[model samples]
Target chain A: MQASMSCRPKWGICKMNQDLIQYLLRLGDSALIQGQRLCEWCGRAPALEEELALMNVGLDLVGQARNWLEYAAELANDGRDADHLAFRRDERAYRNLLLVEQPNGDFAVTVLKQFFYDAWHLAVLEGLTHSSDSRLQGIAAKAVKEVTYHLRRSSEWVERLGDGTEESHQRMLAAIPQLWRFTVELSDSDAVEQRLHAAGLIGDPQQIAAAWQQQVERTFDSATLPLPAPACHFYLSGRQGLHSEHLGLLLAEMQFLPRAYPDATW
Target chain B: MQPGDLIASDLGARAAAPGDLDQAWQVLGRVMDPEVPVVSVVELGIVRALAWDAGHLHVVVTPTYSGCPATEVIEADIRQALEDAGFRAPQLERQLHPAWTTDWITSTGRERLLAYGIAPPLGSANKRSLLGDNGSVNCPQCGSAHTELLSQFGSTACKALYRCCDCREPFDYFKCI
Candidate 1:
């Protein structure tokens, strides 16, 4: 049965594999981009403790990215490995959410971005734990534990900044409008996710979105920040490879080393 | 069948001779975690299983953290240790399911962590810790229950920075994830 499936590339099996690979890329690329953005705060964070926290969270994301990318490469059955998929791909080929690739504007902006992403991340990972794909289940199970801690930390920061001093509150207020539009991609799903979900290999988009919305609203209420109207009309879709200008710049710096030294190795 | 089941069946293809599995376990026991040299990987519960496959020793290991920098180093160390102990090119498999948790750390491992001045994970990693309520971590140095969390993240991904109020000393607490 396994041999027959492998030999038949034109069958539904190939199509399912392709969709699975795309979904994996979405998961992997989001983590890689988000981790890179967090690492940008390494030397410039406000305090020593904050610096460690940012880097630590960043490390976890990057690590998770590798796991997803490695699985994607295996299913791809192409010559490209995880490193090649991560560094060699151009901006349009990347599948990370726009929220992660956005530039780290300010402390308030970063915190809000993280808070929103963490909520969605936890929901998606928890759903993935029950996936029919055993490899994905394992990966998601591991990530859920780490992301649980991440969500707690980021949500606490949202509450702290939103309800703290006057300036802090104002900064968070400004951040809401700036980043809220990008979150449309979080709840939005396309054909790839639909196919995977139908195959029982991924989570239901509506359920994951509902859980995400509940958590975000709860946190915002506690933080005393008004829940902005849903920016559903926004059409930015990172999974479809439509990215903002910021992603190209970020990728330039990130891919420079590998691109410049294609043959270099440790 | 599940992928794990496939691995299990393959492992059953050739059972290890008596004492081979025991010898491999002993070799792995001597192989310590690179980040925390005091505790062996076996003690840390990262080494999940040892089996024989196709006349070669197969070892399965799980990383403590997803992006733990030490995972590669630890794998290499395990391979080197097994090879040095006369196991030929032992196969190393990285398993991600049944994720590594602090609870896996044996009682002896917890003692080693304490003696090394790192407070063991406080309590069971339950749903409560996921909700921003990590139970109080006691100080490893003075055995003080008055330790305060200095930072959610410490020197490593698996640790949180903490300070003992009584002794006024800062230390790392193995986070209960």
Candidate 2:
């Protein structure tokens, strides 16, 4: 099948290489959206240490986004660089998972969101460590160390919340049900996955799902929160350009300067 | 030789030779933090070593804090600046040892930050001496040592947000670690 029109070559633009850019954006946007959500807790966290740790995780994710977006721009063969790709894209152009765009409800919800995503992120990064794409592999290798710490920190919080005060325990337990629906989407399969998997740029989502389930199950068990049933068909269109209403608002705030003043520099 | 002439003659070879230190320091001052983009990494104390090795310039930098987001971009900007100035591919060596401390932020950087409207970090000695073991950071703007830490985490992980009683300006304090 021919590449989509959005992926096609345009006047004054280099040869279209949308698949690679889209794939790279998928990674960058995931980190970007999740990092924004994490940043919301900057001034408000359960405790001082926890606050720093969460902020560190957010920084790591945004750092990862910068690296991946830079590579995406390079692959696009367009003159656009990391800043342009990150700040110039329309809402419909982003391919981040819907779960990342979900607002941070509370401390417990925030930890749950992080725990859910970190578990999947580490698994995917581990797989991508040996990708055929050199740039992707290098970024994943550098990010794996950071994400490992993220997983450890979030997992500790999960257990602490699960075993903490009665109020904390109940709040954390309630967070699980609302957050579980998002996990199904993380390992959801799609045509893009098929192409990338064939190209050896990604691993099988089914395998990733199986591994992620085992990992999260053990962490939840330690957290004392029972695993909730997965949604059969969670928000599935995010990777294909469809997203929740919150995503556009996020892009607007994130891309405001670039949109307002084109080619503006620091 | 007289005492002064003997001292000068002996010091001529021993004096630290002025190399690209001045130029590198100036260029680094222009290289801002990749994420924040307001503060210079040199002022942030992330630049460890700047030397002229053979014909190429070598710069060694460590992260401001462990896994700080600006390290990668800082390295990139360093390379870009040197190349733009007609230097060869600059050698950027990563050194994790002697981890960066907010205490190392040059006085110039602190002044620049204040002039830019963002409060500078309290000197490490002042904070360590004042807070005892609790590690309280005083506000830079109002000289109000009585400040409460809003979050151990600031807008970014490398900083902590504190509010002052005198001015009530919420500012990001560069964490000592």
Candidate 3:
């Protein structure tokens, strides 16, 4: 897989190590997309407290995204900064998970989506803390603390919404299938991950998958929601630049100012 | 010397210093946190270390939170303070390893935070607390241990909104992270 042409520098050339760039994009784009999704709740969350919480979490994720993207930009060394990578890239160039790009349905759906992502995120960060790459280890070490809070908050919400009222529980139950199919991608590792794992730059896929499953099961037990069968077949794979229709729309809104003005700055 | 100055001096001795590094520490000790203006960045423990390399002062900093809006301001403020103190174009390095924790906030910083009406983080940033076992936060206003968390987040990423059961006053608790 070659580097996305759009990600190439304006001199019509790319001098990046393809595998490293791809790996960094996977880390950064996931955080960026997920952060943007959370920020969409700014003025619309159920209560003031929830609003603040959502935005705070969003801020953390975006900050982490900047860190990862900054490193990616450095590695690319292709005349693009983190902002350029974030705003200028086309939808097909993004490497975020399909789950994060999904719409924030109702509050229940949003919470469940966050819970699922947080579980996987914590597992990945915990693993990355032990990475052979010191830079990744440092980023992961810092992020693990923040994601721990995120997971705790989301998992508690899962229990609350799942066991709270007939309406809330039913809503949580309904949200399951709308989001569960995406879980397949959480544990699915392709060659990029396999190569990184072999080099000890990343965690073992089997261990990460096991940790993610254990976390989901523990939270599901507490939430009193029965676990559904894992989705076996899903052609969706965001890492390969295959995204749903939702991502293009999201990029249209998120990239509007930067794309329009080109030279805008605060 | 003030208690804050004492703590800063103690930390200053940790590094085998030239006169410049010690002076830099003194200068940073007066550079207050932008968000929590009552405490200096040194008191907050974000100024991780200071050194001189190739005729340039090198200061290492860590953000209190990953998404802290105040990080850039704090970095700029540190540079400005160093420059104002006669160091030419001091370099700032952001270190992410051994991630910043509330446990790093100094005792004097905690006292200043209480005096400023925000409760300092209770206990340590331990594994149990990270698992959501939040300890009791005492009211900074009335010195009562009876306080309830109004929200997990507050006006800033580093704080949680809390209301004192005794005085019925709402205050910010610096979250343990």
Which candidate tops TM-score?
A: 1
Q: Give the lDDT of residue A143 in candidate 1.
A: 96
lDDT of 3 by residue, B64-83 (tens): 88788999999999977776
What TM-score does each of the candidates earn?
Answer: 0.93, 0.64, 0.91
* Higher-ranked by lDDT: 2 or 3: 3
Q: List the residue pairs that clash in candidate 3.
A: none
lDDT scores for all predictions?
0.89, 0.72, 0.87
Candidate 1 docking classification: medium
DockQ-based class of model 3: medium
TM-score, ranked from best to worst: 1, 3, 2
Tens-place lDDT digits, model 1, residues B12-107: 433234359998899899999888899999999999999888767889999999999999999999987776666666789999889888889989
The parts of candidate 3 lying over 4 Å away from their true place are A1-17, B1-18
For A1-266, candidate 3 gives per-residue lDDT tens digits of: 23466555643224224566788898889989999999999899999999999999999999999988998998777789999999999999999989999999999999999999999899888889998889889899889998998998899999999988999999999999999998888887988788788877788888988888999999899889999887775677898989989999999999999999999889
Assess the local accuracy of residue A107 in candidate 1 as a C-alpha lDDT between 0 and 100: 99
Interface RMSD, candidates in the order listed: 0.9, 8.2, 1.0
DockQ of 1: 0.70
Q: What is the lDDT of residue B163 in candidate 3?
A: 98
Best by lDDT: 1
Q: What range of 10 consecutive residues in model 3 chain B has the weakest lDDT sum?
A: B1-10
Worst window of 10 by summed lDDT in candidate 1 chain A: A1-10
Candidate 2: residue pairs that collide: none
